[model samples]
Target: MRVTIFNYGAGNLFSIQAALRKEGAKPSVTKTGSGMKEADALILPGVGSFDQAANSLPMEEIREVIRSGKPTLGICLGLQLFFGGSEEGRAKGLSLLKGRVRRLPPSVKVPQIGWNTLNVERENELVSGLDKEPWVYYVNSYYPETDGKWVVATSDYGVRFPCLVAEKNFYGTQFHPEKSGATGRTILQNFLKAAKK
Candidate 1:
């Protein structure tokens, strides 16, 4: 499959590409809109503040891809950008999904960087072969706060927050699937499978 990884100046392109390669899919990294037109699937892998990432994105181009209903996956900050807006910055998000990203409660460590278990709230192809409660890697200070309808899985870091979400063809994960191990590869493979359909 031709997977296009969006590079809007804030994503971990190299690692993400490596992960995709490991999953048996070659990836093309680009910041231009032209790449999206020929892609079978889109992966937005990010690692940085929301405002900077939002500023770097080609808004109209991204919206066009979303409107087309192409399978799109967002990781880490990439996922946060799918929301209406984020508390991390004043810049608006792609707003592909109805929700807002908020800073994690002060009760827990600001940036919960480590392995955490996910509580699957619903079943979907994205987590197709994952265990009931699978461990994934995370590094973030903000999480999405949305209705249960959009949440497919959640994790507890001081509070039960949405960790995995899906709405139609769009899917997102708060953790870095590229950084996670076998479970992460499964998730990527599932996303590719979904794209084929």
Candidate 2:
């Protein structure tokens, strides 16, 4: 499938693209509306601040892609971008998912960088064939709080926080599955499978 990766000046796109290639999926990087419209599925990978990331490209096509009900996945700041707003900046988000991104509780380290075990919640397509409590790489200060039961996974830094979320055709992960080794690639594979479904 033509899986498009959003390249809005805020993500580790190369690694994600490479991972998609490994999964035998045709992936392309784009930052324009038309480029987004041509894709069967999309991946929004984020590694920068929420405000800068969202404000970089306020493309309506990207928003519509999420609303179109086709499979869409967000990683790290990409996950935070699904919220109505973020604590990192004043810029509003696409609001595809019901929630707000806020600073990870101060009880933990500031960046919350490094590997952490993921607590899988429900049996969703994103983690359908993966093991529970898989260790994934994370690097963020803000976390998403969805109003509904969208939470798919949780992780502990200083306190437990939502590590992954899935709602209908929408999916998000706070951890960088592309950087999390074998299990990480497996997570991407799970996403690819979901997209195919």
Candidate 3:
């Protein structure tokens, strides 16, 4: 299926493209709204600050995509951008999910870089074929503290935070599955399969 990886000038688009292709998906990366609107599935990937990523894109079209109820996946800053607001910036997001992003406290590393294992909290389509303690790559400081229902997985560093999230047509991961090897591929494959449904 054709999947468009959002090319909003911040994410590691080529790596995400490679990951999708590895999952047997015919994927393309673009910054245009029309390309995004016509894709069978869309992936929002980001690799920078919240405000830089937010202000650099067409927010209205993105909101419309989420509202369309088609399958969409977000990663890292892309995931953080789905929230109402982020402590990383004063600007607002698509608010597709109800929550605010906050930076991890100084107790641990600011970026929280490297491999960490995520514990599946609820049975969801995202981690369907993955192992119980899946090690995923991460490079972020801020995360969403979702309420009870939306959380699909949790990972601990200095403290536990939402790692995988799913709500209807929308899905997000705080970790980078593209960089996580086999376990990461499983997560992306699951997303591709779920989008077909």
Q: How does each model score on lDDT?
A: 0.86, 0.81, 0.85
Model 3: worst 10 consecutive residues (lDDT sum): 4-13
Residue 51 lDDT in candidate 3: 78
Extract clashing residue pairs from model 2: none
The clash number for model 3 is 0
TM-scores for all predictions? 0.95, 0.93, 0.95
Candidate 3 off by > 4 Å: none
lDDT of 2 by residue, 115-196 (tens): 9898887777777667655889988888887656888888887767788899888789999999999888887888888888
Those runs of model 1 whose alpha carbons end farther than 4 Å from true positions after fitting are none
Best model number under lDDT: 1
Question: Local error of candidate 3 at 191, Å?
Answer: 0.2
TM-score of 1: 0.95
In candidate 1, the residue pairs with backbone N, CA or C atoms under 3 Å apart (3 or more residues apart, or in different chains) clash, namely: none
- As for TM-score, the candidate ahead, 1 or 2, is 1
lDDT assessment of candidate 3: 0.85
Instruction: Return model 1's CA RMSD, one decimal.
Output: 1.3
